[model samples]
Target chain A: MSSLDLRNLKINVGGKPIVKDFSLTVPKGEVHALMGPNGSGKSTLAKALAGHEDYEIVGGEAFLNGQNILEMETDEISRAGLFMAFQYPSEIPGVSIANFIRAALTARLAENEELDAAQYYRRLYEKMDLLKIDRKFTARSVNEGFSGGEKKRCEILQMAMLQPQIAIMDETDSGLDIDALRIVSEGVNTMRGPNLGILLITHYQRLLEYIVPDRVHVMWDGRIVRSGGKNLALELEEKGYDWVKEEVAAV
Target chain B: MPATIEKETSSESIAIDRDIGNFKYKEDYSYDAGTGLSEKTVEYISNVKNEEEWVRDFRLKALKIFESKPTPTHWASKDLENIDYSKIRYYLSKGQQPSRTWDEVPDDVKETFERLGIPEQERKFLAGVEAQFDSEAAYSNMKTKLAEEGVIFVGSTEGLKEHPEIFRKFFGKVIPTGDNKFSALNSAVFSGGSFIYVPPGVHVKQPLQAYFRINAENFGQFERTLIIADEGSEVTYMEGCTAPKFETTTLHSAVVELVAMKGARIQYITVQNWSENVFNLVTKRGMAMEDATIKWIDCNIGSRLTMKYPGVILKGRGARGEVLSIALANDGQHQDTGAKMIHAANDTTSNIIAKSISVGTGRSSYRGLVQMPKHLKNCKNNTECDALLINTNSRTDTYPAINVRGDGNSVQHEASVSKVSAEQIFYMQQRGLSEAQAMSLAVNGFVNDLIREFPMEYSVELKRLIDLQMEGSVG
Candidate 1:
């Protein structure tokens, strides 16, 4: 089993501190919901943990199963079992989905080793079927001309294929409808097990109703200020974020 | 000056597995017109070919025209100044008619093509094969099924000797000697290129292949190619070139003229991987009649300096033309290529898509000319050129001359120069692809829309070549 542990993390973007002194840990078998309002710096935290170069870690310690990832390059961190599903995935025109994943898998192989086309496609079709993705989608350019729902689905498809130990889905529910949310949530839920730890970042409590998380943490002004069980998400949904802001102001 | 092939790869990781572009040259010249271009050199070439008096006179007139014209000074590259005309041998060949059978072909010539995989390719995908050594074709063969259907695939000399009735009608008419300085010189010393004539209503199912090899240094390979697709006929011709590296430079100046009669279609594809020391200057143009179509799909990967613009004239109602090209310029190379489209009739259409990659200090440019006169009603044209720079010092330029006088016509031009973005690389790398594979995929994707027009085999090899070019550029 693997885990994603972040301790006293401080992150800056373009010389401006966005996330400060944030600490959270999602163990191997559980999903943690990080709920925050806009400008809460959730994305900056996710990007920094994924080793994005722009997300400067002024002070932080991140580990993928005790392997320091803050010191590694973005790609190296990925190979070290960290994945971030983008809120707005980039469109790669003319590169088919099949080929993109194949390249990634090929990259992970030892030098001079090759991917077996037959077994690879067999596994791909199986996963595509599980996600209800059309067989023809594999031939289309990655995320090019895809709808919002389709983009999220494709991201899930990639996560399924890459099989990362810890996946931070940044706004995976953002722009998706109720039906699409159910499908994408189902795709992620199927992958949640002892081998996969998911950090579901969302602005709304609506997603947690479908894919319930083991714990909920409220992020405000960069760091997590409150922590509770699954009921915290429902309380935020009823009380709205202003209640938390007022509480923090009083404190 | 011995001709050798220098395979350049800065990183062992790139070529260690792919091992492409490892071509070598072996010379066996039986009729060497030696170094220097003069009336005597022209006369010696004509005598060796045993040409008729009229053809000899045509060569003399073209040579005189070539002498009178000055080198083109307005283009992007000035490497022409380095070509020592007096030191370049005009013609060299293994003295014999091109045999139809591979067994009769000279051993050196056969072995050279064997390395290049010509005969094997013929067996796999081609319907015809013409392998030219320096100045003359050493082997020319066509599938008997195509020959039975009146598809004539032969060397230019044989085309002149046997089909004078057809050859004389369109030899220099489309691209005459006075068209340009290079065309004039090619007309004077041209030899060994393919002469394809598809008769009315006959469609060649498979593409005809021609391989041009330059095996000697300080030599110029001037090959003239002419293709005529008669009414309602269709044909595709693919030509490949591989030259040897030498201390001194070589010149490959070719003139290709194509004519598509009413309702016919012609597709000409070129894959030029000349050595870095070769100056590849060429003039290629085609005329499309009523309801006819002409397409030029060209890929240029090697050479010190290349300046070529394959053009098409849409001369009749409803005619269509297209030029799809990709150029890769490595260090010490400049690829100056583009397309030309002229609309002379109503309802004519044309499109041009050119993509280029510049590595290190290499430079790539697109120069295009599109014209539609006022009288041509409802003529339309579209041109696009995109360039990718691989390094900080890599260079790219665009010069498009568009004159759309036709009030009822429309013209559109689009061009972009971009470096492969670090963000794009990161996106790919996040998926676990190495830097080289990511860059290679980006380059391939840049031209993939046009590359899809190539045959599957060609596209695969083109992808490999691009991978080789992209290697070592990024860590």
Candidate 2:
């Protein structure tokens, strides 16, 4: 009943049309993999859905649980149960991870409610332990001078803390080695449940071997051209995006 | 139909406090030295205080110097031309002796300090406290144990009358009366500042604090502070300043001097939050003897135009000097501040790090001077100045003069100007923070490292004030 539904979404970046006639539905309790090669507009869709000012939604209807999110602002969309894990997370110097997360959490509370420090730290430590992150990482500035793997892990850490209903992770597996990829996939799997829906965007089939999405959608140019089950990933891996390009051309 | 996620067990929200220190109270003063500046005004102040002939002569001579100097329009801001000396009330006081206890203080003055939370701060972490209202000190007190340990902390008026011998020795030695135009103005009608003297080998553990409050409209508060640390002594002194919002312009010109003897250490900290209609021009400097150390930590916020550059003269060999400062200039305000370091002896070292943020149309400038003569050997100096501009209309400037002419002496200067990037704000916005909150967080991060150098309580207060200033900075 609860889902992220996109119908005929049109997007433009800097007055240049990038995504035209895009549609998808990711229901609660399911993981959908949006697979595409370079410049297929996978990342643009994620940024536009999150209300980035640079990505202008020229024509679209994005509904999250029957509430249209295209009319909301960036922070409002976030507060309305949407989260985005960036491809290249920003480096905010001198702002500790603990304080940044705390500020974000504080923004969601009612006006007069005060945060309890003791319980917050206990839960933060629990999440950090679950992700195999060192406890000292909380005191360091957010994403400043972090390794590629560490930055991705920090993104997942925030996703776990914010606990949004629907999440769009763009290129979370890039720039990570094999061990890091396995660890990150484990963290994501640990957070998956009937209450959460994830739209995982990636260019590689290697990532699907770990997370094992229930559905896979292949994008071409600016639209989803093919859709199938988990084994379709194996078919695409065996052939390649070039084969899909030929198939779409024939259609 | 999104599922209800469990709430995080924390709840800390950013609240805006625009007028935390901008409130004021009215008081009927028994002594007012009328408006305008003249020899008669200076003489009237000295005659009322019953100062000796020598002090009165000193004030009269300094008044002449103040009259002779030009408005300094050539180098400083053009805003200096707007200050009308003839319209400002030079002196105001209740004419009551500074009470040693809060109960003995007059009711109105006591309520003013109480509203400012002076007594509460004094009880928590201060060794001594002095509360100055307008032109005179209302209350001055210290712990008995510190008094027994030979620590002298009292108002300047009492210091001049009771301990003339020691007070007169170094009163204007570090910063001379004719050093600058504002210094001359302060020397002519100075009142209500602290006078401290620490004996040899006496280490005052806690900080000695003084609170300067400006409550009168169109009034000038001139406070003179002199601190002398005898050989091998150490002391930390902090002073906070605030003024109420007034339609007319107010003037605050104070002169502070320090003398640190051989192997002595003196640390001075200042947090000034004047209203938008006040001009804060202050002269603060110190002298460091052989193996002595002097450090200044200054934070300037909420002033229309502030010109203060705390300096140190390394007179003896192996002396050290450092200055750490933070300045924030909001709409209709200008924060012009920096540091000066003079290395006169061999093996001397100095460090200066200044960070400023300019919001709206506010302007902030960093003006610095560092000199190491060719005669000095093995001297080192490091200077860093960073500025952050919040809006397109905001402005910042840096002027640094370094003159080091020795073979083995080394100097390093680094200056940077940055704007909070749009990408950074967008990244934070995706996490549910409003644009203003994100800007405040970014501004706080820019100055976070510098603020860690401040004391715990002051740092907390400074952060709250900064948050308040950034409230409407963005749409």
Candidate 3:
């Protein structure tokens, strides 16, 4: 079984330490949620795990299936079965969404192995139908002039297509309306099964109601100070982050 | 006495004959202007071509104007100063009549054109083929069906000899010889360009193609072309050029005039990839009558210096003109190309879209003019010019002059200059394309809109040419 191990990771951005000594283990067949208040470094942890150039690994290691991911390039890290859905994906003009994703998938294939066009289109159309996206959307430029809901749905579509071993969703529920949120959660739920590990980063417990996680962790000031079952999300949501702050103060 | 002996022995003082053996196509025709321009030379060319006295007088007048007018000193580079008129051969044509079959063409000349893929295009889809070697059209033929339908496709000399009335009517109407010094030179010694006329109410679906090859050194090719599309007629014309590399420079000055009658449509496409030793100065213009349409699709790939501006005059109401131009300049090439539009009647419209790519110290300049008369109402013009520089040493410039006098006229002009960014290359590389492939794709995508306007075969050839230019582009 595949697993991603983050051992005492310390991440820094712009010379300020953000993710400090945070540790989490997501083995295959489990869905984990990291919930925290704003500026608690949840996004930083996700980005650092994804090997974004802006984040520096000052200390500690992140391993994908027992291999260090810190040594690989961003694209290499991606091809090595770790996928991070961006909080804000880049908008590439003049590049169609279908071509972009096809390029990514083509890159993942072995040399001298050509992608079967018929099979690719069949799977693409099926997934697009499931996501309720128009088939004509494949011809439009990548994320150019797309609405917020469209962009989120596009990201989810890519996630579904790539089918990474460890899917890191960084605030996937943000900017989505109620119906869109349900659709996105249902998409995530459909992909949740054996042979896949999920790390969902969110600011509210509302999303946890749909895709309930096996474990919920509370992050405060760049570190996870508490860990509990699914009810921890409900408790934190009911009492607010001030309770966590008061508990830390008591500590 | 000793000095005279030394002068005779030295290479500089002897009066060496400059008639570098005439091209194979010129075997049948007499060399009227052996090597230079004079009143006698103009007279010889006119008489040898059996031109009307009026045409001869026009040539004489143009030769006088050419002799008196000074060269352009203010234009880009002004490298025409080095052209020695006395050392250049003006007119050389094969003495044989235009051939109706490929078998009638001389084998050597036919092989050369075949190597350049001219005959294949004719055999496949072209409605007509005119292959000009040096100063003479070696082969000219049209489909029998087109001939039966009263389509006239022949050389300009033949047109002057056989259809003088129609020839004289529109000879210099669009672009007069006195328009520029090159045009004056072309008029004085012009030979061997295509003459096409479509009968009324007829539409030629397939393209007519002409291939011009310059195989001799220090030779000047001045071909005068005139095309007339009758009412409700449609036609498309494609032309290409290639020449072997030479040490000394060669001069190519051609004049093409087009007339489109009411409800007629004309499309002229040119792909010129001359060797780097040729100076290509061509004048091409078209006049559109009421409800007529004219389009110029020009792609410039190679030349030492090219100064061509295809123009269209909207003289009748509801006339339309369009120009789509693309230029790629490698090392030691300067492509100074653009389009001009003149609105003379009400409700006329024009659009000019041009894209250029420069690499390895090459320079590309866009010079355009759009004018609407004060009395013309509801005329509209949109001009967009973009340049992409592939290297730091390359350069691009845009010079657009717009004069809209009427209050109701609408005009828009936009220009942008951009370079291939390193980040774009890296981004594409991250997606698995090599650096060269990425550059090619980016350059292709940059001109995707204009390239799509070309025919399918031409689009494939253009992509191959762009890919060749992108080779060795990265460090």
Candidate 4:
């Protein structure tokens, strides 16, 4: 029911061009994995799409369900049904995870409408269960004193609760052990539905083994150089990103 | 719902409190004793109260001291000079009996508390609640079970006259009249504050609450509070203050003295929300004896100017003291608050945590002092004061004085002043929260560490107040 359309996007950090002439789209009912090595501008693109102020959007027009999102504020973009699961979520002290998610959900409500706390808690507990997280996790401050795996799982929990139209997951598999990796991947797989579009950015193909993407794109030097089916992920994993760079240079 | 659409806009009406002055009670004081302070005023107050000779003499002596002392000159709250001692009515009371039931209270008085939800809160959480209207307490209630446990809770007047054996010993010993100019004034004309005495070895689980309101214009609300927790007993007392806006400035000067006997624990909490035209000058201190603990949890918001420093003196082995404070200053307001910890005995410890938020051109200052004399050994103190400025011109200042004269005493003081970063706000906004909500969340997060020191109901009320205060805090 929703679609993310990015046409020739450019992003700069600290006045230096990082993501140059990038273009990609993950339509509803599909999962697209953008795989690249370190410093390949994958994270920058994700942050810019979420309207992070630090990532100066140089030239880009992102449309979410036919709505122009480039001119909108960060919160406006979020309310328009765009989401980003950060690689390193901030640890807000004294703000419990329950309150944080509740605020996020409440922000989407109309001014006169009130949030149903009972139904909210019911859904929150259900999400926690689906993500294999303890109900006690809601009591702790968001990401405060949490383990690496715990933080990543919290991101998934937020995604489940928000249920945005398009979700950009940045390195959701990084910093996660084998056990946490599978659980996070399972959450993504279960979340893959016709009403949701996902762009899972990762450095490794192991994440794709759990939630196989419909399309695999290998990015090098801030641009996607190769695109193929899920088989491309296996080929890229067998050969390093250096092989993709060589293949692109040969052209 | 509190925000009103006012067609008239004045430059001075720029603060966030553009609409909220619903707290007003009809005034029909039978004994208004006119304005101005004199020996006759002191005699009139004592006479009205039917006080004993010693109490009357105490008032007269305090009045002299108050007259002799000068207003503080070098304080950050420059508005202190604006108080007109000559025009302030020293005493105003209705001469009505305090009712144990709400129906017996005057309609206007009951409605004021009802609007403030005092009765509901008391029924929900507190074991006892007392209310001070203008100059005297008009209502008091206590759960019979708690009263049966020898927990004495009454107004200062009744406490002094009825329980002299308990109140006489520790009344003036903690904070003497000569402590400060405002305390001297309070000692002279003080009335209608909570007087709580917990018998030895009895623990009062539910907190005792006091609600103080200023309903009469040009009337000075001076309430002297004395709380004594006997040996091995524990009690927590909380108070809330609210005043309506007046064309002329109002004055609220209170003195609170707390004594924690051997192995006793006492915690005192204050939440003050005064109108914009009020000057709140207060003096509060506590004394902790052998193996006792005393804590002051104070929050100051919505006053034109506030100058208060809650202190504690650790006087016995293993005695402990702490002061956790939160201050918020909006436009046309000055919040100058801090804490003091004095170590007087071996193995005594204390801690002070103060957090302040300044908006627009408002100013918030932290002035802390911790001292350990030479004779005190194995004493420790930790003082941390953090300030958050919401605007470019908002001001914050920290002045911490730590003096350690003994070999085994250690003191630590940490202070920081920071602004809410645009990046943090953006991060929160990206999660669909508005800019104002993001800012409020960040500010509340800063003081979240210290607010945990409060009771459950109080912390919830504080959070709601913060959210309401943050509605227009950011431009």
Per-residue error for B98 in candidate 1, Å, reads 2.8
The native-contact fractions of the candidates, in order shown, are: 0.51, 0.81, 0.07, 0.63
Candidate 2 residue lDDT tens string, B453-475: 98898898888878878985676
- lDDT for residue A19 in candidate 4, whole number 0-100: 89
Model 3, span A1-251: residue lDDT tens: 54999889999999999989988899988989999999999998887776666789999988999989989766677777887776666555556778667766887788779888889888888888888889999877766698777887888888788888898889988888888888888888888899889999999999999899999999999999899999999999999999999999899
Worst 10 residues of 2 chain B by lDDT: B7-16
For model 4, what TM-score does chain A reach? 0.98
- Chain B TM (all candidates): 0.95, 0.95, 0.91, 0.95
| Candidate 1 lDDT over residue span B1-475, tens digit each | 3344234434534543544433445555789998899989999999999999998999999999999988777655667888889999999998749988999887767777876789999999999999998899999999999999999999999999999999999999889888988898888888889899999999998999999988878989999999999999999999999875677888999999999999999999999988789999999999999999999999999899999999999998999999999999998899999999988889999999999999888999999999998887899999999998978899999999999995899988888887877777777878877678888988887888889999877888788878877774565
Q: Give all TM-scores, in the order shown.
A: 0.90, 0.96, 0.76, 0.88
| Interface RMSD measured for model 3 | 4.0
- List model 4 lDDT by residue over A1-251, tens digit each: 44999888888999999988888888998999999999999998888888887899889678999998889888999989888888888777678889889999999999779999999999999988989899999989878798989999998899899999899999998899999999998988888899899998999999999989999998888898889999999999898889998888899
Sort every candidate by lDDT, greatest first.
2, 1, 4, 3
lDDT by residue for model 2 over A1-251, one digit each (tens)? 85899999999999988898999999988999999899999999999998889999999699988889999888888888889999999988889999999998998898789778898899899999999999999999999999999999999999999999999999999999999999899999999999889999999999998898989999989999999998888889899999999999999
Task: Report the lDDT of model 3 for residue B263.
Answer: 87
Runs with alpha carbons beyond 4 Å of true place in candidate 2: B1-16
The better candidate by TM-score, 2 or 4, is 2
Which of the predicted structures, 2 or 3, would earn the higher DockQ when compared with the native? Answer: 2
Top DockQ prediction, candidate number: 2
